[model samples]
Target: MSNLAPSLTAARQLADEYPNHKVTLLLLTDFQLFDADINRVLTDIATFPGDVHAVVLGGTQVDGLMDERVQITKATYTDPPGTVARAIFASLVNHRPGARPI
Candidate 1:
């Protein structure tokens, strides 16, 4: 089963409890600022049993960290929400076992 939680702590707990299933933590926000702690969050997600995908919904910043495993697509101005949702769906569908879908 897939688990979608808001907080990282909760997500971690879920991951620990369901070590055999996939746990995805979706963060829906505009990419305005890049947080330094994002690295830690990514690290935690990587340790999960299933694939971890982050669907960022926002405009790409110039200084955003470029991770080959993380896929970052530009959300269209006309329908940003829909674009984000589609991107997340695509990520989930394309995600492979023991691999990170970026």
Candidate 2:
């Protein structure tokens, strides 16, 4: 899905449901695909304690969205999944070595 709002909400819900476990969300989409206010999405993402990363296709990166929790990539049609995988792997290697995805 283009919008991250719904996914973010679901991730938050999952986190709430499993308070003792880690909750992570990986979102892949085209840039500017948010159906809700970008500010609200950003706020939700920023406040989220669990991991959240994104691979966004083709658009200027939002100023505040590339923090420790978010990774946006401009995916190419030829290898969108590869692009996302690389982004996720890079984030993991750089940020949390030896960590496995949940």
Candidate 3:
């Protein structure tokens, strides 16, 4: 759901169809993801037309390789999905004014 245009398009459509529900997009930045391009990431966030939030944390990697990390079972802080679940819940409950993406 982090693929910028497609994601925002889908979320916007869903949100419009279901105005009673909260729609959010959680993006994880790093010490970077495997493809970790800070410029593109920032651009995507800035250009997004829907609710989006970010959590920057250390990424799990070894020698700049993803396969190695997967073999080692190392976890990114935002893995397991539940971590993101909690963040979404928190954001919904305590939203700061002007913090949402436009």
Candidate 4:
């Protein structure tokens, strides 16, 4: 969602600070340079102590889906923001049981 640098930094910090907490990151933006950075972040998060889940909303190509520890969701701006959020939330809740925040 944020720029690559901030996103990575935040993810690292969160993973470090709250190792026992479940962490989910949502990246929603458009950039051709995000692939490598996102991959690195995901790798780091997966190695963190807690459970880390990431949903990438605007990626073009993803190479690691069978890893079981990380997930990547590629989405475009084909609908309104509200619709997009709903869809993302639905998918997340479906894939990750008890992930929805009420």
Candidate 5:
């Protein structure tokens, strides 16, 4: 989806439906689609019970996007498949335990 808020909202709603399980949201993006609408969703996501990890493709890291609540990794589309996978894996491994990467 082009809009980040709606996608994240839907994910949050889906997680709400299954209250017994912890949800993990793996958001892969190029850091190019966000607008003002994402701010509110970010606020909500801060309190979300599940884990949120953003795998930023193309190495285009957005300023102010990294916060204590969300895990983020920077990888390039030009990188080899295994390199990207290792970067993602390392990021998740360093994240808090019990989170299932999506």
Candidate 6:
């Protein structure tokens, strides 16, 4: 919706923070549109030094991503949830390819 402007502005700030640095944006939101708004985020992120990964937790996606430099992943829920440690381990184990462990 029209609320995307603020999000885009925040994304720009996040992207411009470290010129030589790489960033992984994890968005834990209600849903994903895979629309122009998200495309804008991908576009801004594409200007970074290398490939950028955007993970959306607890979201629904209708379309596949089109950007080569930006990868989008969406995760949903099941069986309630787990402990923080378990979640962290799972996330690390299922971590995105082409990225190193933190």
Best by lDDT: 5
Clashes of each: 3, 0, 0, 2, 0, 0
Ranking by lDDT: 5, 2, 4, 1, 6, 3
Worst 10 residues of 4 by lDDT: 27-36
Q: What is the C-alpha lDDT of each candidate?
A: 0.53, 0.67, 0.47, 0.54, 0.69, 0.49
Quick one: how many clashes does candidate 1 have?
A: 3
Best by TM-score: 5
For the record, the alpha-carbon RMSD of candidate 4 to the native fold, in angstroms, is 4.9
- Please write out the lDDT profile of model 5 over residues 1-102, one tens digit for every residue: 345777777888899999987677777777676556666766765667678777777777565865577877777857667765765665555545775544
User: What lDDT would candidate 4 get against the real structure?
Assistant: 0.54
Winner on lDDT (2 vs 4): 2
- Distance (Å) between predicted and true CA of 97, model 2? 8.4
Residue 63 of model 3 has an lDDT of: 44
Which candidate model has the greater TM-score, 3 or 5?
Answer: 5
lDDT tens per residue, model 6, 50-77: 4444554554562454356555555566
Better of 5 and 6 by TM-score: 5
Instruction: Write the residue-wise lDDT of candidate 2 on 3-39 in tens digits.
Output: 7788788888888988886655666666565475877
In candidate 6, list every pair of residues with a backbone clash: none
Candidates' TM-scores? 0.53, 0.65, 0.36, 0.50, 0.69, 0.46
Report the C-alpha displacement of residue 85, candidate 5, in angstroms.
4.0
TM-score, predicted candidate 1 vs. hidden true structure:
0.53
Steric clash pairs (candidate 5): none
Which is the winner by TM-score between candidate 3 and candidate 6? 6
Model 1, 1-99: lDDT tens per residue?
A: 112223556767777897666555544445443545665655554554444455544455623453444445656476635677676766665535565
For lDDT, candidate 4 versus 5, the one ahead is 5
lDDT of 5 at 62: 63
Off by over 4 Å in 1: 1-6, 32-38, 45-48, 62-66, 76-81, 91-102
